[model samples]
Target chain A: QKEVEQDPGPLSVPEGAIVSLNCTYSNSAFQYFMWYRQYSRKGPELLMYTYSSGNKEDGRFTAQVDKSSKYISLFIRDSQPSDSATYLCAMSAVTGGSYIPTFGRGTSLIVHP
Target chain B: DAGITQSPRHKVTETGTPVTLRCHQTENHRYMYWYRQDPGHGLRLIHYSYGVKDTDKGEVSDGYSVSRSKTEDFLLTLESATSSQTSVYFCAISELLAGGFHEQFFGPGTRLTVL
Candidate 1:
């Protein structure tokens, strides 16, 4: 099994709909969890970041992490068409004196207008 | 785009040719990383540097090499590029925050196609 698992979803949703994207991992040592958004032909940009387990809210975006279940999620409330992009989940631990994140294959989201 | 820039944003080269991609950062972050993105596979780390002249191999370091002679520049070289090496490459810089947490910012990415 891969260290991280995320559905490669072309998840289509109507405008103003709420969107939920999730990823699961097996590493219990992963203390830092992050979400990144990438547009077509562009590099991934940091969207949300959370440490350990808890929820962090930023405007319309919320990031949740569950260390016990090894699950993480990103919730987009009242999504807009401009929110269409690939969402990637990454987690890292301080290994070998460095923190290198392991990424899951991104989920493609399309908020149609 | 946190003061990070990657050169040769697009390139096409024949197999067995040598190629070099450069990542330049102005943020002066102590951590720099190289990653490749491809279909079915997410971003895979190729290499990373913690300080000048300090570099280490990543998961997919085979068939690739890197050099960091200066703090602002980190270069990845494919001594003999292959079709399998063709992919979008990204350079990232990390800013260490309080409590030992770090955030990474990526550059615009370089697309390389080998035929």
Candidate 2:
């Protein structure tokens, strides 16, 4: 099984709607979880990050991690056309030295105005 | 914007040619990573540097080699570029903060085409 799994969604939605993107991991050791957004032909930019198992909010973006269920999610409220990009989930285990990160296939999102 | 810079934003090289990509950072981070993005595979690690003169191989480091002579620079060299190596490359720097695996900041990607 893959260490991390995410839905590669080209999900299309209207502007102002809420969007939820999720990822699941097989390793319970992942203590650091992060979400990154990428535009076409561009490198990914960190969106939101959470430590251990809890919710972290930054402006219009929220990141949730449920260690018990091995699931992580990023919720964007009042989504805008500017949010149209690929969302990626990345996690790292404290045991694996302190640098190597495991990434999931990004979920593409498009918000139409 | 972690003060990371990647050179040669776009390049097209012939297959079997040697190509080297550079990642320069002003953050003085201890951890530097090299990754490539493709259609199905989101981002795969190619190589990483722990500190000056300290480097390690990643999952996809078979066709690549890296060096970190200084704290601010990391270089990834493709010995013999292949069509399979035609992908967008990204460089990242991780700070000691952010819970062991801090938010990794990325550079603007380098688009490479091996024809």
Candidate 3:
């Protein structure tokens, strides 16, 4: 099994709908969780990040992490068409004196107008 | 937009040819990384540097090599490019914060196609 697993979803939703994207991992040592948004032909951009298990709210986006279950999620409130992009989950732990992040396959989201 | 720029945003080369992708950052971050993105494989790390001339191989570093002679520049070289090496490549930099937490910023990707 991959270290990090995420559903490669072409999840389609209408405007103003709430969207939830999730990822699961097997590493218990992961302490840093991050969510990135990537558009077509562009590099991934850091959207939200959390230190450990908890919820962080940033305007229209919320990030949640559960250390016990090794699960992480990103919730988008009142999504808009401009929110269409691929969401990637990344996690890292301070191992061997450095942190090397592991990434999920990514979930594609499309907010229709 | 972390003051990062990747050159040759797009390129097409024949198999067995040598190819290099450059990642330049002005943020002066201590950590730099190289990654490749494919359709199903979101992004895979190729290599990373912690300081000038300090580097290490990543999961998919078999057919590739990286160099960091300066803090602002990191280069990924494909000795003999293969069709399998054709993919979009991204460079990222992270600065260590007070609490040891870091946030990485990426540059515009470089798309390479090998035929």
Candidate 4:
């Protein structure tokens, strides 16, 4: 099985709706979880980063990691049209650096007015 | 913003031709990586370097090769490009391993189109 799994969703939501994107993994070895946002024809930008498990909040975004279940999530409060992009989840273990890390297919989010 | 720049920003070449993409960083970061993004595939690592003269292959290193003779420069070469090799390439740098904490900074991608 792929180490990391995420829904490649074209999830459409109305503006001001709360958006949540998630990914699950089978590798308990993964210690670092990251969320990246990529606009069409652009590079992936690091959005939220978390280590191990727990929740981290920054402004309107929150990232949660559950090491026990190997699940991670990113929540966006008050979504905007500018927030429409592909959300990719990446994770790595301390020993897997040379192995190229693991990435999910990325969920496509579109917040419309 | 990443203190990193990717040259050619855009490239188009015929299949079977040799192509080189350059990634230069001003951050002096020790770790450099090359990744490609294809439709439906998040991003796949092609190669990475921990330091100068130190490089290693990633999962998709079949048609690609890389060299890092200098600390701040990492170059990726496709000896004989194929249509399958056409994708957006990204260069990233990290001061150290994430350790489940540190973040890797990414440069604007170079769009490569092989026809």
* Residue A7's lDDT in candidate 4: 90
User: Rank by lDDT, descending?
Assistant: 1, 3, 2, 4
The DockQ score of candidate 1 comes to: 0.83
In terms of lDDT, the poorest run of 10 residues in model 3 chain A is: A93-102
State candidate 2's TM-score: 0.96
TM-score of each: 0.97, 0.96, 0.97, 0.94
- Candidate 1, residues A1-113: lDDT per residue as tens digits? 99999999899999999999999999898999999999999889989899889999999999999998999999999999999999999999966587689999999999999
TM-score of chain A of each: 0.97, 0.96, 0.97, 0.95
What ranking of all candidate models by TM-score puts the best one first? Answer: 1, 3, 2, 4
Span of ten consecutive residues with least summed lDDT in model 3 chain B: B95-104
lDDT (CA) per prediction: 0.94, 0.91, 0.92, 0.88
TM-score of chain B of 3: 0.96
The lDDT of model 4 is 0.88
Q: Give the TM-score of candidate 3.
A: 0.97
Q: Write the per-residue lDDT of candidate 4 for residues A1-113, one digit (tens) a residue.
A: 78899999899999999998999999888877889888897778889788788999999999999998889999999999999999999998867445345889999999999
Interface RMSD (Cα, Å) for model 1? 0.8
Worst 10 residues of 4 chain A by lDDT: A92-101
Model 3 per-residue lDDT tens digits across residues A1-113: 99999999999999999999999999898999999999887888889889988999999999999998889999999999999999999999966575688999999999999
How far residue B64's Cα lies from its native spot in candidate 3, in Å, is 0.5
